[model samples]
Target: MAELEAQAPTPERGLAVRGLRLAFGDTVVQHDVSFYVAPASIFVIMGVSGCGKSTLLRHIIDLQRSAVGDISFDGQRLVNAEPARRAALQRRIGVLFQSTALWSSMTVGENVALPMQLHTHMRAGEIRDQVAFKLALVGLAGQEQRMPSELSGGMAKRAGLARAIALDPDYLFLDEPSAGLDPITSQRLDALIMRMRDALGLSVIAVSHELPSIFTIADDSIYLDNQSKTAIAHGNPRHLVEHAEDARVRAFLKREPIDEPARATTNEY
Candidate 1:
């Protein structure tokens, strides 16, 4: 069982989940899941559909209760922290949901400014300036007047991302960002994530099932196994693809052909 104990997490560990177990009612979703995300690194959570990938994210973000384990960020324990502390910790975190989660009634600029409006006392001019900067950073410059319905899927994703960073969070969490995007658009989004990481030194936690995107952006990843109800593989995607001892892991990596439609092709030999 997860205790209500709160021990300050070490600062060097950007986000840490230890001995985590999750369940909904009587059904167990995950077991003993542990991982540490270093600052400025992109850590991916990957697994087959219904394999508890999103469940893990929910626990880390404190959106769902874990049956057992503890979660901490930047020296604060999220599980038993005071409401004020929890809110403060969450403000340093940003999340881009699978749907982009933009409001249809709001314009792009309004959507990006919403976080600042809610979280800070900045003047309207400052919010506008910050929105403009974030939009430019995401390659959506001058589209502030555009509606969510007006954007292509990729553009909408970028807008959602801009909103996520409006408060300039230290950690970012993306859930299946590449879902429903075309190959080129997905690759572009992956590159954008890297650029954001490099520019802002973000510690990113991404939950993804997209194989190509997983390999391209993740510095470290943990693969959850539905059967064992725990993580079956953890490491660099490239290294795991080549050297994971588990047959299931090797099979999963080999299941996709390199020339598959969604895979990015390179010109290099």
Candidate 2:
């Protein structure tokens, strides 16, 4: 594992977002968004649908170039870093997309080993050993040969998580990690996330609107507002719910749908 450990980042630190602005052609998603993800902490990005939560995530992972602002990981600028530098930064992080993003054609073990095969000079035997270790960590041990189609939703999410951490990244990004999961399964996943943070000291950034999951796992959070075109609230989800000055933030936490159309009714004269 020395080769894998050799690629790890030195002097652990957190992620910082400053003055971030994102747009696509004529439409702007978010602007002037700023927040900090503490080292080894689980920070959540949350908002209603189309509120640019994912867009902000894309910017952080360098999937989409931000129209303005800067993002730094461990003190290195990510916005305009050199290609080599960007690639190096990428090696220190891992992302689990909303869809799990596993290849249907590949077995679970193969899916997890793919990244190592692409990025490292690790021997096949070593890769196999690491793959097994990660799968075990995620509670998916001995299911390496199972296809994506063969696993349940919870199993698949766990498998995807294993794949994300195969390289032992210092930072992990998850997009709606509990989407479509049952409450029990979601809670289990949240627990796994906590274990990862506590045990590995990995900083995690998650985008989720599941209140239970968010409150269960988030150490900090940033809420993007579509109307404001920027972050409107930032803090622990529970703290924000209880004391945030924004009505919308409180409404969201209360599970009151803010935009539901009023029902039509005939009044008796």
Runs of candidate 2 with Cα error greater than 4 angstroms are 1-12, 259-269
lDDT of 2 at 164: 95
Between which residue pairs do clashes occur in model 2? none
Q: What lDDT is reached at residue 1 by model 1?
A: 40
RMSD of each: 6.7, 8.1
| Candidate 2's TM-score | 0.91
Task: Tell me the tens digit of each residue's lDDT in model 2 across 26-82.
Answer: 677788787889899999999887788888888899988865677788878776789
Distance (Å) between predicted and true CA of 77, model 2?
0.6
Instruction: Report the lDDT tens digits of candidate 1 across residue range 20-121.
Output: 888887778888888889899999998777788887888888898764688888767787779999999999999999999999999999999999999999
